[model samples]
Target chain A: MNPSLHFRPLRPAVAADGATTLDLLITVRSPEHPPMQLKERPGLNLALVIDRSGSMAGSKLSHARKAARFLAGELTERDRLAIVTFDEEVNVLVPSQPVRDPLLFISAINTIHSGGCTALFDGWLAGATQVANQLDPAGLNRVLLLSDGQANEGLTDAEAIAAKVEGLTQRGISTSAFGLGSGFDEDLMGAMAAAGDGTLAQIESPKQLADLYASELQGLASTVGRKVSIGIRAKHGAELVDLLNDLPLTSAGNHQLPNLRYGQELSVGVRLQLPAWMPNQEIASVRLAWDSPDQEGRKTLIEQLTLPVKPEAELEGLEVDPEVAEQLALLRANRERRLAIEELDRGDLRAAMASIEAIDQRLKGLPQSDAITRERRLLAEKKELMTQDRNLSRKRLRRESLRSSLNVWESGDDNV
Target chain B: MADSLSLSTAASLGSDSLYGLEELLALAGERLGEEVTPRTVRLYATEGLIDRPGKDRRRAVYGQRHLLQLLLIRALARRGLSLTAIAPLVTCSDEELGQQLLQLEEPSPSAEQQEALSYLQSLQGERSLSSSPGSSASLLPLLGSPLSSSSASLSPQRSLSTRSAGRSNVASSRWHRFSLAPGVELHLSESASIPPAGKRREAWLARLLERLREQLESES
Candidate 1:
């Protein structure tokens, strides 16, 4: 059986104008009903990439090691694991091998000690290679890189490091990035995950590392869908502007989406400037194809939506659909959150406050009571943190911003 | 204005009749033997899976586009595809859809392909019956109206009455069919509290039909 995947392609029927660009939300959700528990899944080949730089020596390193122990204990004998620690150089403490006795790996992880300058890129590259060497095409192959300092030794640029991760992903190895403490480069970690087709997370404190690592592990082990890709071909006179928030879009084209897990609805908001059209004209065509656990061949589903060209007056009279409005509001809120962070970083407290207020206003207008209410409350708490401590505000913003842009559900809201 | 005038008088103007929501539901039952409700039709419209009624809420009028889309929705839903998957097809122009229909109607058969083609046809026959809520395959042949595959193109200008058979199944077994109005029907299972067939049953059925007609009129 092929992956039970379906596409919910949505766009406003009437655009504001021919020259104007409107947002399109293409969401992919597994068609399978909610199972009682994460069904028995295939094994995972995970490489743990840890930063052993001086900055990570104290609380960060201790928590990371604890997280490693928790991970080692969680895996079954069938799963394969690797541990690579780096500072000025990279060292494979435990090579890629089955988790027959996790204690052996945990003890090796305990022996790791902090050393010289940070070599972030080299560390991730070595870990990604290790995972790829034992790549299980049928199983999940991932590299979880945790860093608490900037790359000072080699390949320091974020784009360069992200490009390397992109190459690794193309070869069937994805890299998830975790930024620990304030010293780490949030931009680099976010870029790695966005380009490598994995989740990006910011650990504000060392204590949260264990829970975050456990959650990431749970997400990896419960994978129900893989190699999910969507291609969009706009008819003549239309341009596919962008997949907003720079989703894990591939260099292959802007069409591909990141892999999906059960209960995760990847919502990609696309902006397009469509040309004038007659009534019932096909504006665009979308093809979604995926490979499931039981499927030997890729299953493809194609859909073409017709957008009729109505007069501006008519469009104005038509009521804006509530769902469309809600999605647009979410996108707007995400944009403002990023803007607020940037303003705060520049020390323009007034500008940051304005952006935060905008997010609050946008969330209030959305229809989903539960989702909107929670988001509004989080925004208020985030504002209080911003004025209280700058470091804490920055950390909170980075974590929330990454999750917001990637559309990752909160801990308890995973199945919802 | 002329288009609206023609649409308002379409009932007497033959094939390209502008159907009310009720008329569309009745036609779905007559042609496909499927019990489609007005609510489902409204849903398809809201989801953009079917052409919406032209006028504002007060005097809404559904045309040939809506009729063609409703039928196509039913046809695609029977193939085990979700509505999200089929929503794109609702955007296809009549000409584009005609081409797809042409492709679906004709198959190139080589010696080796014959076996697979037969299997697919048999699967289609079986699936149309089992998939729908209360529809059955046996009653489809009762339409008896000979329809060519080409005659069923989704062109808005073409009347839907000429649509080819074998697209779906009809209602059967442990079922009761009632005529609530001209071209309108009510399909009920035997479990319904319908009186036995006699003078009391006749009176009960008449009253039931009258009440149904009144309800439909009020909603419209």
Candidate 2:
């Protein structure tokens, strides 16, 4: 029994006669400082995988270099940097060096020139190796790979590269892939990020690359916790239906409990459906269990929480507070709505319009009036954008570009 | 008088005499494959569709007449008319009821009903029953299936008389009227019937009533 144990029950803001019943139990623990005294200045290992193929000679290369310089400036004295530029073959420009030497890093990023076919995989693998070697079990290890063209060289298979990076994620290194221009493989970059336990985003033009990099770097600085896991054991006839932590249900994998460092805070969202009961019958115990590192080498159970279900009518006027659950639901809904809009802009007019309609209806029912208004406006704008044939290319570009930026922001927030 | 006495005695000797109020209500609902709340019992009493026996405030008793009235009320309520609207039609003479119903339906007759009516009228013209006001009776037998016969005698005169009485009572009692949507009129009314099995009877009664109204309107 932790002294800081607090329980919150969630109820819908307004209860209608036929409204669906949603019950949630959220336990907030008092902030506990990590037992171990970790380093105050964490290391940052960034691998800038740039494309130097023949198509990138003019504005593309200029924008790429400028973006690289912007990213270099974001690194602090505690950070380490590496620059890997690729064309037909990969080249290690700066290798793995400390960001303390800003001038050297910027110059190295600027010297890269363009020539032959793009070998995006080679650049990513080279960058991964550099970061993996400099991995401080305590520091944030990341790779930022950018490309203007598709991979057309050795080990060009996107799936194989994603699988390789997925293996790297197991070793605690995360990669963020940025696709530049419309011709590049969006799926390949996205899969790479997914496998690397990071994210993939599309940059329609080189101009947006710097701001994107700066934002990604800022996200790295706010990292509080990583690899967070939550386990729940429901009462008989009850099961955990979903768990969303700022993302939708992508794929189900094995549960991994990672250690939490000092100054890190992680939030987990859970949803459960309990068996229907007769009036006045007590709901059986629902247990929530989680594991985090203690002072010793072994992981300790942080808290085991429980909640009881009572009839909705009887619980009238009692403030139902399921903040975690509500946050999770809101986040999931937002992601789904965003994905639907993306599909719509891709020339799949029917699906896109349908998605907007669903999102519009959902927004109308949301408790947050502000969110509803904002979402409604966005849906309307997207619908208008969909109707104009001339605007198709621009709309597609805008949609992908905005999606990437949003994904980075979300991923950064999740790490916080 | 002797025949009336035997009829009353036989009804009393039947299951009505053996059951308590709660058991009777339960039986009513069970017979109709529904669940009747206490409110439904009160509603039937308020409408005079069910007779409450005596000054025994603690345990009110009801009889077979109550059941019959409930069955009739259920039947009329199913024809897309509100209880208030059905009340007058239920107690009117067949001729009067036919005229009133025809007036109500002519404004916005549904496509299906119009088609059925046209078919029936065309058939009537061939048989030369076209000019008679009483020609509705000819349509009744054609329209009445076995299901409808069990619920209520499709004789328009009987339905009209009952509906007229019900209408006056409804007006005097200030009971609210609930209307059902077009095709759903009969189904919902029967479902919400008071004596429970009233719902099933209501369904059959609805078809017969609809056919009668349609036939009368075509003749007019």
Please provide TM-scores computed only on chain A for all of the candidate models, following their numbering.
0.85, 0.72
Considering just the first chain, candidate 1 attains a TM-score of: 0.85
Best by TM-score: 1
Query: What value of lDDT does candidate 1 attain over all alpha carbons?
Result: 0.64
User: What level of docking quality does candidate 2 show?
Assistant: incorrect
The DockQ of predicted model 1 stands at 0.00
**lDDT tens readout by residue for model 2, A1-416:** 21132334465332222222344544334245432554444567677888877667778889999988888887876777878787655677765656664765675666666655676766777787667645555567778888866676545568877766666665557788887776677657766766665646666667877778876765565444443333445444556676443322113333332223334333444566655543333333332232221121222244443443455565476665545444544445545655664675575777767766775676565576554465466556666666764243333433333331123322222111
Give the runs in model 1 whose Cα sits over 4 Å from its true position. A1-12, A15-23, A33-39, A236-243, A271-276, A290-299, A307-312, A366-368, A404-416, B1-220
Global CA lDDT computed for model 2: 0.52
